[model samples]
Target: MDAATSGTEDKTPHRFHRSLSGLGVIILTLSVLSPGVSIFVSGASILQQAGTGSVIAFLIGAVVCYCQTALIAELGAAYPTAGYDYAAIGHAMGDWAGATTYIATLINMPVFLNLSAIGIAIYLAPFGIPLSATMITFITIATVTALAMLNIRANEMLTGIFMLIEFAALLLVAAIGVWHAQPDAAVCVLNPVHLDNGVWIAASIGIIGIAVNNSSWALAGASQALMFSEDMKRPETIGRIILIAFLLTVFFEIAPVFGTIVGAHDLKAVLANDAPFETFLGQYLPAFLLKLVSLSIAIAIFNACLAGFVGLGRTVFSMGRTELFTAPINHALTRLTRRTDAPWVALLLLGTSTALATYIPLTAKLLLLSGSTTILTIFYVLGVYIGRRSGRTGARYRTPLFPLIPLLGVGIVIGEAVVLWLDAETGRKSLFICAGAYLLAFCYYRFVLMRRPGGWKMRGPDDIDALVARDVVDA
Candidate 1:
C-alpha cells in the first residue's frame, strides 16, 4: 500500500471510533491501576516496614504519580497518540531514546500479562479451582488474544464493566472489614506508640517509592485514551479525563493500604503468605462474601491483562506505522479489512510474545525492568523542559509549577534508581538485562534491520519541520 493510501488518515476503524467519556476514561484508569488484590499482596512486605507510615508512603507516591500525570497530560493535549511513551520520548529525546523506550515497553508488555495470569491463579486457588500454573498462563494468553481481536469499542465497554465490578468488590471488602472488626479496630489507627518515628519515616519513604513505582502498573495505559484524542468529541476534554483517572488511581491505592493496616497486625506475615486480601476476607467476612471478593480479584486481574494487551498492541502498531520496525510489519498494520482498520498483525505479535513468555519464570523480573524503563523514559518529556524554556505558547493543557514538578519527578526516579543500584540483587540484574536488550536492539537497527528493503530512516529536524508545516496546513 502506498503511504497516502495506507489508511493512515482513517486510522480509526469504525468500530474503534466511539467516543470515550470522562467516566469511561476513569474506569479505564481504574482497570489499569486497580489490580487491588495483586498490588496489596505484592506490597505487603514493604508495608510492614512502613508501619503506620504505609499510608503516608502511598500518599507521597500519589503525589509523584500526579506530577508525572501532569507532565504526560500536557503532552497528550498537544500530540495525543497511541504509542505514548514511544512517541513522546522519540519526539523529545531522539531516535535512540525512543527506540529504547519501545523495546522496554515491548518487553514489559508480556510481563504484565504474565503477572495478571499469576494473579488469576492465586485468586482462584481458595475456591478449589486448582488450575495448574501452565493452564493459567495459557488461559491468560488466550483470553487477551481473543479480547484484542474484538472491536476497540467493545473492548472499552468490557473494560468499563469489569472495572466497575472491581471497584464494587473492593468497596465491599473495605465495608466488611469495618463491620467485622473487633473493638480494637481503633488500636490499628490510634496507637501512636506503635509507630516508631525513625523506623516509620524510613519505611514511609521506601514504601512511597515502591508505591510510585507500582503506580506504573496501575496507571499503565491512561495515556491510551489520548491516543484516541482525534476521535474525541472535544480533544481538550482528554485533559479532564486524565486528571480524573489520576485522582481515582490515588484513591484506589490509598484505600486498600489503609484497610489492610487496620485489619492485620502482622502485615509482613500476612503478605509473605500471599493472597493477603483473600485471607483477610476469609478471616472476617462470610464464606460466600469471601468467595465473591476472590472472584472479583480474578476479574480485576483479567481487566488489567486486557488493558495491557490493548496498549501493547497499539504501541507496536504505531511503531510499525512510523517504519521503526520491519516494513512487512508496517505493511500488515497498515492493511485494514473492509470491516475494521485494526492492526491485526500487531495484535497477533503482541499476543504471541505474551504467550511465549508464559513458559518463563522471568515475569516478575521483567516487570521490574519494565517499570524502571518506563520511569527512565519520562525524561523524554523534555517537551516540558523545552516548552518552559522557550516559553512556547499553545492551547494545550499545561502542568502546574512548570518545570518544578517535572524536575521533582526526575529526582524521585533517579533516587529510586539509586536505591535499586544499592540493592544489586534486584536492581543490578534488572539494569543489566535492560542494558543488554537495548544493545541488541541497537545492533539490529544499525547492522541488519536498517539494511532491509523499505526500512525507515530516523526522523531528523527537517522531518519535524515538514510535519509541523503539514499540521499547520491541515489546521
Candidate 2:
C-alpha cells in the first residue's frame, strides 16, 4: 500500500464525485473571485488613490497577477486536489512550509469570510432595510452556509445564477461610465492624475504603486481554481481554467473601474465620497436602477460568501485527510454527507468559526491581516521554483519562461510585503502577526509532527483508474 493511503482502510478513502465540467468549475471559481465585490471595494480604493491613474495601476496589478498565475497554474495542474496551496507547496517545498501556508490560511480565511458577509449589510442599506451590520452578517453567514451545505453541482447552479446577476450589475456600471465619457479621459489613462485636496496633481509613482497593490486584490481569486481541481472532469485542464478565469476577471473588474474613472461627471466629488462607487452610480442612475444595482451588490456579496464557505470547507477537508491531526479529529473532519459527498463536518466547523470571527471587535486588525495575506502567493511561487530546481516537473502544463516568470512573481510579492511592513500603524503589525503564526506552525511541525509514529506523510489525490476500479468492485 502507498504510504499516502496506509492506515485508511477503516477510514475508507473518499473521492469527490468528479461530476463538474470545466465550465462548472470556472463558474464556481469566478463566484469565488466575486468580481462585483472586488470592484466595489478594491477597485474603489485604487480609484481613490490613483484617480485617473488607476488605469495604469490595475494594468500593473494584472501583470503581477499574471506572473503569479503562471506559478499557480503549473503547480495546480501538478497536484490537483482540494488541499490547494497546502498540497502544492508541501509537494514542492516541504511539509514545514506547507504547514506554514495552511496555518496562514487558517488565520486569514475566516476573517475574509466575516468581512464578505458583513459587506452585504452596506449594500442592502440602500434598499431601506433596517438591519445592523452584525445582524446582517449573521443572517448572511447562515444563508450562505446553508447554501454551501448543498451538493457541489447544486451550489454551482445557484452560484451561477447569482453570478449572472452580479455580472449584469458590473456591465451596467461599465455602460454608465463609458456611455458618459468625460473629456480628456483618454489622456488621463496615459498621464494619470489624482485629486489632492482641491487641486488635481500628477499621481506620484509611489502612489500609483500603492494603487497597483490595491488593484491586485481586486484582480485576485482566479487561482481559486485550485480549490476545485479534484471535482473537475479533466484535472489537466485546470491550468487553462485558471488562466481563463484571470483574463475574464481582469476584463470584468477593470472595465467597470476604468469606466467609472473616465465617465465621472464630477471626479472630485466621486472620489471624495466614502462610498465612491455608490456615489458614482447615484449620479448617473435613476433611483430605481440604483436600488437594483444595490440589490445586485448585496447578492454579489452573498454569492462570494457562499463560494468562500464552500472552498474553506474543502480546505479543512483536505487538512483532515493528512496526518497533521489526531485520528479522531481527522475522522470527524473527513466525514461526508454520504448522499452528496459534501464535507458536512468541515462546513459546520467553518460556519461556526466564521460566525465567531464576525464577532471579533478588532475589525481593523482583521482587515490588516486580510491585506497582508497576499504574502502567501510568494510561498506559492517559491514552491514552483523549488520544484523546477529539483526536476519534479511532472505537471503537463508547464509555465512558459521557466524560472524567469516564477522569479519575477517572487520579486513582486516580496516588494508588496516590504511595502506592507513599512506602514507603521497597520501593515507592520500585520506582518509581525503573520510571522508569529508561521513560527508556531513551524514549531508544531518540527517538534510535534516529526516525532509522531509514522512521521508526516503526504497524500495526493486518488488516481482516476484506481477510483474506477474501486467503484466496479463495490458494485
Candidate 3:
C-alpha cells in the first residue's frame, strides 16, 4: 500500500496514484468528448433539423453547458475522488441520492459503449475495412479494455496521441470552410435558412430551440474530467482543467460544424446527404484525403471508447472502495493489479458487459435518453444547493455568483425534460421509459440498499481539513 493508506485501518483500500498531469487529464476528457464523431453525428442531426441555424443552436448549447461548470468545478475541487458525481452528491446530499444516481448512470455506460463501438463500422467502411459490425465491436471492446488496464499515465500518453489525429480531422474541416469562404456564408449564422419542400425559407425559433437542445449531446462530455479527480497530480487544478476542457470542447466541436455549414458549395445537397460532413469533404478533397479523414473518425471513436472505459472502471472502483455493494462484490472490484495499480477486474467486467450489449439491438431514442442531461444535471444542481446550504463549499475553488450558475443549469435542463415530454414520437416515449428505470433505481436504493448493514456508507475526500488533520493524503 502507498503512504496514503498506511494509517487507515481499512484493508485492501482501493486507491489511485496521483500520476496524471492536468494536460493529460484534459486530453482524456477531450478524447471522451470525441469532437470528430460528435461532429459527424450530433452535428449532422442539428444540420438536418435546423439547417444553417445549427450555428446558433451550437452557441446556445455551449451556453447551457457552461452554466453547469460552476457546480462541477466547485464540487470537484471539494471532493477530488474517482467516485466523481456520486462522491460529490453523496457528501453534499446523502448516501441514498448518491448511490441511486450512481446506479442510474452506471446502467447507461454500456449503452454509450455499444453505440460508439457500433459506429466504427459506419466510418471505417469508407476506408475499405472488411470487418462486420459484430466483429468490429468485439475487437474494439477487447482492444480498449486491454489499453484501459494499463497504468493511468500510459493510457494518458496513448490517448494524447489519438487526440492529435482527432483534432487534425476537425482542423481540416474548419480550414476547408475558411478557404472556400462563400459570399453568403454569413447568412448561415445570421439569417439561418432551411430548405423546405425544395425552397429556401427562414427557420422558425421553435426549430432552432429544438436544434439547440439536440446540440447538447455534442457538447456534454467535458464534465467527464471530474471522473479523473483522484488521479490528478494536482487535484486543486481540477476546476481550471474542467473549465478549460469545456471551453475547448465547445470550440473544437463548433468549429468543424460551422465550417461545414459555411464552406458547403451546395447547402441543399450537403444537408440531403445522410453523412453531411463526409459529403461536404468529398466535394473539396481528393479521394485519399477523404479516406484519411474517414479513418480519423474511426480512430476518434476508438479513443472515445477507450477513455470512457477508463472512467467507468475508476467509478466502479471508487464505489467498491466505499463498500457500497455486497462484501464479495466490493472485494472483487477493489482488486487492483499490483504492477499497474489498475482496476483490472472492474474494467474487464464492464468490458465484457459492453461487448455482450452490442448484440442487443436497441433503439436510437433509448440511447439518446441514456445520455440525457436532464437527470444528471438535476443532481449537480442539488449538490450545489445542498453544499451551499450546509456550508460545505470550503474547497480551494468556489462557484462564482453564488447559486446563479447552478440554478440556471437546473432551469435549462428542466426545460429540456419538458421538451422531451412534449415530443411524443422522438422523446416522450423515451422519457416514460427512463422514468420507470429511475423509479426502480430509487426503490432499490431505499428499500434494499438502505436495509443493508451499515446502510450504503460512502468513503471519499469530502473534507480536506480532516485529511490534513489526520496527516492522510487526500489524493
Candidate 4:
C-alpha cells in the first residue's frame, strides 16, 4: 500500500480500531485466562489449601477482582490505549512507577501462554506426540503470533472459537464430576469446614492466597482485556463484560472444582494432588472420553498463546512508543506494518519469552519473580484511590466504596503477598528475587533509561503526578 492508500498514522501510537464487540471482549477475557488449565491445576491448589470451602475463597477473590477491575475500567477510560496496565499506572502513579511496574508485571502475561502451552503438551503426552513441550511452545508462539499479526478480525474470530471449546471442556469435566458424585458429596462440599481444627483453619487462611491466586488467575484474564481498550466498541461497557466473564469463571472453574470435591469426597487427597479434577475424572471416565477431554483441555490452553501475545505485544509496544527502552530496539518494537498495523517487532520480542515456560517449574512460574507484580499493583490500587478524584471529573463510570474499597484492595493484595511469604514455600523462595527485581528495574529506570533523551522527553519526572481525572466521577 502506498502512502496515500495507507492514509494518516493513528496519532494514538499503535492504535487498534474499536472493532471488537462486547462478546469479543468476553471471549478474549476467558481465552487469556485459560480456565481449562486453571481449573485443573489451580483448582487442585485451592482444594489442597481450603478443601470443599474453596468455593467461598473463590467468591472472596472475585470481590477483590471486581474492585481491581473497577479501577482498571476507569484507567482504561482515561487512557483508552493498548497496554493500559503501564499506561494507566504511568498516568495515575507517574513515569518512574509506570516504567517499573511495566517491566515487573511482564511475568504475569507469559504464564498465560506458558501454562496453556504446557496444557497442550500434558494433554497430548498420552498419545506420545514426538514434539517436546519446548517445540510445541515455539510452534504455538509462531502460529499465534502470525494470526495476531494478520488482522484483528481474524484474531477475534479464532479466539472466540477456542473460548467455546474451553467452555465445552470445562463442561465435560463438571458434568462428569457432578453425575458420578456421591450422595453426600454436595452437602459435604458446602459444609463450612472440610477438617475443622486450628491446624486446618490456619492452613485455609494461608491457602486463601492460593485460592485467590486461582480466582485472580481466572479473573486476571478479565482484567487484562483492557489492554485493547482502543479496540472495544464501548469502553464503559468493559466493566459489564468483565462482570459476565467473572460469572463464567465461577461457573466453569468453581462448579467443576465443587463437583470434584463431591466426587472424590477426600479432602486430604484433593489437597495433595495438583490436578484433582483430572485424577477423579480419570478414574471414572473411559479411556476414549478421557483422551477426548484431554484434547479439549489442550486446545483450550493453546488458545491462550494467541491472546497472551496480543496483550504482551501491546504492552511492549506501548513502552516502546514511550521510548522506555533504548532507541534502536524501541523504534522497532513500536513500529507498525502498513498492511496490518501490527507490532511485528513487539510480537517477536514477546515470542522470545516462551523459552522460560518450557523449562521453569510451575512453583517457580507462579512464585518466582512474581512478587514484583503484587508490589506494583499495590501502587495501582493506591494510584486509583488518589487519582480518581485528583482533578477534573464528570465521568460515565466510577467504582463505589471509594477510598474504603481501594484502600481495602491495597491491604488485601499486600496481605496476600505477605501471607504468601510466611506460609507458602513458593513465596519464601522467590520473595527476595521479586523484591530485588523491583529495586533493579527502578534503579535502571531512574539512573539509566530516564537519563536518556528519549525516555526523558516522553516520561519526564515532573509529569508523574499529572492528573488523568477526566471522565471519572464521584460516585
**What TM-score against the true fold does each predicted structure earn?**
0.81, 0.93, 0.93, 0.85
Please list the C-alpha lDDT of all candidates, in the order they appear. Answer: 0.59, 0.79, 0.79, 0.65
Which 10 consecutive residues of model 3 have the lowest summed lDDT?
1-10
lDDT of 4 at 80: 49
Steric overlap count per candidate: 1, 0, 0, 2
Model 1 reaches what TM-score against the true structure? 0.81
Per-residue accuracy of model 1 over 1-475 as CA lDDT, tens digit each: 1222545443432213445566665565566555464355554544544454555555666666677777777656544556565555554444555566665556666666666666688677778866686788778778777776665666678988888888887676566555555555565445421234333323344454655565443433455565544334455566667777777666665677567666664544444443556666666668887778778878888887776666566666666656566546656654433444455777777778777877666645453554354455355346567644443312356788866887876876676566556556666667667667666766766676557776534332223335433543554
Tens digits of per-residue lDDT, candidate 3, 1-475, equal: 3212333524534567788889989999899878887898668878888889998999998888787766777777666778876777766677777777777666677777878888888888876668787898899999999999888888888989999999999999999988897888996779988877767889998888888887876787777897887788787788889889998888898998889888998889888778888889988999899888888999999999999899888888887777767878877787777667778888998899889887665775364453346777787888888876766644567777776788788788777887787787767777766666667777878887889876766676434335522422322
Evaluate model 3: give its lDDT. Answer: 0.79
Candidate 2, which segments miss by more than 4 Å at Cα? 1-12, 362-374, 464-475
Candidate 4: residue pairs that collide: 48-271, 395-471
Clashing pairs in 1: 33-218
Misplaced by over 4 Å in model 3 are: 1-12, 364-372, 461-475
How far is 67's C-alpha from truth in model 4 (Å)?
2.8
Span of 10 residues, lowest total lDDT, candidate 4? 460-469
